[model samples]
Target chain A: MRAIVIQAPHDIRVREVPDPTIQQPTDVVLRVLRSCVCGSDLWAYRGESARRPGQRIGHEFLGIVEEAGHEVNGFAPGDLVVVPFRWSDGTCAYCAEGLTTSCPQGGFWGSVGSDGGQGEAVRVPFADGTLVKLPSAAATDDRLLTALLALSDVLGTGHHAAVGAGVRPGSTVAVVGDGAVGLCGVMAAKRLGAGRIIALGRHSARTDIARTFGATDVVAERGDAALAAVRELTRGEGAHCVIEAVGTEQSMRTAIGVVRDGGAIGYVGVPHGSGTGLDLDAMFDRNITLRGGVAPVRAYIPELLPDVLDGTIDPSPVFDLTVGLDGVADGYKAMDERTALKVLIKP
Target chain B: MRAIVIQAPHDIRVREVPDPTIQQPTDVVLRVLRSCVCGSDLWAYRGESARRPGQRIGHEFLGIVEEAGHEVNGFAPGDLVVVPFRWSDGTCAYCAEGLTTSCPQGGFWGSVGSDGGQGEAVRVPFADGTLVKLPSAAATDDRLLTALLALSDVLGTGHHAAVGAGVRPGSTVAVVGDGAVGLCGVMAAKRLGAGRIIALGRHSARTDIARTFGATDVVAERGDAALAAVRELTRGEGAHCVIEAVGTEQSMRTAIGVVRDGGAIGYVGVPHGSGTGLDLDAMFDRNITLRGGVAPVRAYIPELLPDVLDGTIDPSPVFDLTVGLDGVADGYKAMDERTALKVLIKP
Candidate 1:
């Protein structure tokens, strides 16, 4: 089987790897149909996040179940399913509370000993708990399949940010970052009925997509200017909710600055860099709320899937580039060079 | 008129000061009936929080309206009232949003050029917004008055913490301080229908008050031991809601340690010292939320007043010492030396 591997910083390769097999009673083998490069992947590619040579690299995919163990009751061969970034046991206390990311028995894809999603086939543990079955027809519909693939990570993460920000029918939301997840956040806020959405991004192409995703306003400025622009648009009060999709310290600062006093910030970007923590004194004085982390996409998928299936939200637009399994390195390079919003791969 | 003044660290004096009068069209002058020494005050007393010599010091009090300005529509002379720690214009956007503490026109009592609650009279700005009218009968009921006084700060603060923590029916709550505010948090959690409440404190006396207020369990451990005890009590998942009323770095760390995955920490303690900010890495991985600050007591007064009036909760137990106008100095000393949980004053 061909799989993407991180050989070194700025070096991605598609190489022959041993095929995955069901190793446990609850395991199943998946033949991946779709996977993509994520904004988070850029961190390791940039040598910012440490990664060992030849480590598996992707964590988002939708696929057909190629094989199932005896205990895997919810899924069987030939069934299409979407996999969340992390796998959970579904019955743990955290999982029951809708925090599957914290499930004690769960682990992320692409970890040291695990199979990455950007591969021909991978072994999935806790089959019933880790995979969401997709409609049979989605296996052949490219557009719908792309949208369903988003359910595996970005769309659900965006929903998590919106939920964390307390987006409601009349909320004013400001999303910081123009990446795929941030664009998805705009869609999530709109789906949740946000009255106004302000997207902060400098790129015209990304901001154009943001407008299509339901951003009522776009602030192209950075730093103080961006803060000023958001405050001006919000009548000097700032937005009621802020979605922080970029984990950089500057992005977090912008989020803190643009959120109104007493408003909340929902931050889902994987934290990287130094001094990324909140300014406690400022947060305290303003009575602001900071919530969000690695999103529990598994918990959110059930709710967001219906909208996607019904065509109410088409998150497929986030994928601006596509590649074949052999071109996985090009997908990583395109995303790294900002030439693609998100790169989808067909295995 | 006489008022408590901060002469220096460890030095408090009740000295004759100019009597307060309605200074603006929105101001009301109140003749103090009851005021209390707060744990926050001990900061200035111990020279931790900077205070100028001769600065007025208290910010919790109930009184009779001695005079009202032409624009003070809701309050008049001879009316009994309870004052929030800060005065906010009732019509401000923040106040309308129920975040009165963030009102642009709001100001704290005891600030420079303002009369403190420990004085015989106070000139309250935004009379219609800052003061909640008390039943005329409360003036004579010492017990009810004490409970009402708690609404001026501690009780409302506790309610803020509970609300911030997302306390719901059947929640398991942990309160991380034994001060008046933390005890009130226990009561708040109970009032909100929390099924289990854990109070963390070392003092038997305060924990007893916490039990009376509604703490179903008490953990006297500190640091890792405290974290271990709370995790054990909650079946290794920690509490669903944690109220952090101690502003020290250690207390904040304990709060972070004792909250369950995807749980929230409501912190109302006035932040002091270095390294009091959140550990963002840990929070991000666990999906924890941090909220709460200087409470919007003015907005909460109306909701909590009815409970106090009907004796549903009595926060008076926190006031273990009483002092008269001339004995304000001793009140400060007793609170500073930890001889009293809270000290009530009559002026």
Candidate 2:
């Protein structure tokens, strides 16, 4: 089978790799129907995050179960499902409390835990907890699979940001990124009844798609100009909720500054790779609520899958391009080069 | 009329000043039945905050309405009333929003644009908004009057802290600072139905008082130790709500450290005179909600006054010492020296 491998910084290759087999009693082998490189993947690709040889990377995917281990009872071979990025036991105290990302027994698929998901075959542990079965569709239904693939990670992440920000009906929300995930955040804000959705994006194409995803306004101006624009629209009080989808010093500050006093600030962007500081002096006076670290993706996938099935929220607008395993290297390149909103990969 | 005047820092003198008279249609002249020195008063007495020559220096008082301006009909002559340290015009936008301290047209008494409350007689402007007329028995009840004197500031400030923190039934509250305000916070938490109240204080007397006011446990600990104590009681999740009463770096950090993930923090300690910083990095991961600055004490007095009237909560325990008008200097010295929890000045 073929897989996209990071050869080094700025060097990615689509190369042959052995297919995965179920390794644990609870594990299920997924024949990848669709997968995508996340925004975090670009960090290592751009040399910001350390890259190493023989390391498998991507974590977002939807697939047909090729095999299920003995202990996995809820899923069976050939079942269509969305595989959330994190594999969890689902019985840990943290997961029980809806903080799946912090679950002591749960671990991320691609990061310091098990194998990555961007391949022809990937083994998912604790299938009952991590995989959400979708209604079976024909193999030719690429669009539905691609959209469901989004719910596995980015869409769930966007909803996490919206929920953490405590967005409500007739509430104003500001989303601070133009990436596919941020576009999904716009969609999530819309689904959650946010009155005004402001997408802070520099790219014209991305902003247009963001509007389709429920962004009511576009803030092309970066940093202070963008925050001032948001505040101006909000009668100088700023938005009721702001999503920090870009994890940078500037973006974090914008998230804090653009939220109204007593408002909520939710961030889904990985602050791990970015050098950002939480200036409490700035946040304290405004009395803002700061929440969200990593998206508890698994917790959301179950609740959001129905919305996707019912056409309540189309998470597919994010898939700007599609590629095969052989084209996955170019997919990463296109996203890193800012030419694609997101590139869906089929194995 | 004899009054306490801070002619300069370290130079408080009980001197004969002109008798206060009603000067505005909404003003009322109060014959000061009781007054007290506050911890904030020491900021000027110790040369921390700016102090001007011949300026009267107290803001906490309970007195009888000796005379009322023609427009002041809510309280008749001889009606006993307790004052809110902050005098708001009641009709201002900020006042309507329940942020009387941030009232656009009102100013802090003794600082600028307002008269002082610490003397034999006081000319209280916006008397209708500032005065809380207790039920008739308060005129002869010394303890209730002294506690009502507390309602002018500390008691009101405590209610502000608890309400701002959103304390309710089953809320696990941690009260930082064991002063009169801190003790009042403990009582307010009980009144608000906090299942557990942890009082962080250094003094034995104050801790005992805290216990009396429904503090389930006392942390004779500061900062890290205090947070540890609070966590031990909370099954390692710290507190559901935190009230920050001390305006210092250490106390502020303690407040942040002692709250659970997604818990709320309310601060109202005048912000260490200038400002203070928060632990944004840890707070982001914890998903904490931070609220409070200068409390709108006026907005809270209306609801709290009745509780004091019916003796549902005894705010009187805060006054550990009492003195006559001539002993006002002694009152200031006792509070400054930490010899009294609070010193009630009788004029």
Best by DockQ: 1
List the candidate 1 regions with Cα displacement exceeding 4 Å: A273-277, B273-277
Candidate 1: global Cα-lDDT? 0.92
Q: Model 2, B234: alpha-carbon shift in Å?
A: 3.5
Where does candidate 2 stray beyond 4 Å? A1-23, A42-55, A138-140, A219-228, A247-249, A267-286, A323-339, B1-33, B37-59, B65-79, B92-94, B119-131, B163-166, B221-229, B269-277, B323-338
Per residue, candidate 2 scores C-alpha lDDT tens digits across B1-347 of 88888888878888887888878889999888888888888888888889778888889887888898999868889888878787777776556777676555566667754557677888888887777787768778877777777788998788878876779999889998888888888999999999999988888999999999999988887657777788889888888799988777777788888987767777777666213446555665555666665566777888888888788888888888888877877777888889888888887
The local distance difference test score of each candidate is 0.92, 0.80
Q: Could you tell me how far off, in angstroms, the CA of residue A248 lies in candidate 1 after the best superposition? A: 1.9
Candidate 1, residue A91: how far the Cα is off, in Å: 2.3
Which digits, one per residue and each the tens of the lDDT, describe model 1 over residues B1-347?
89999989999998999888777999999999999888999999999988989999899999999899999899889999999999899998888988999999999888888888998889999899889999999999988988899989999999999999989999999999999999999999999999999999999999999999999999999999999999999899899899999898888899999999999999999887413447777889999998898899989988998988998888999999999988878988887877889999988
Supply fnat for every model shown: 0.72, 0.19
Best by lDDT: 1
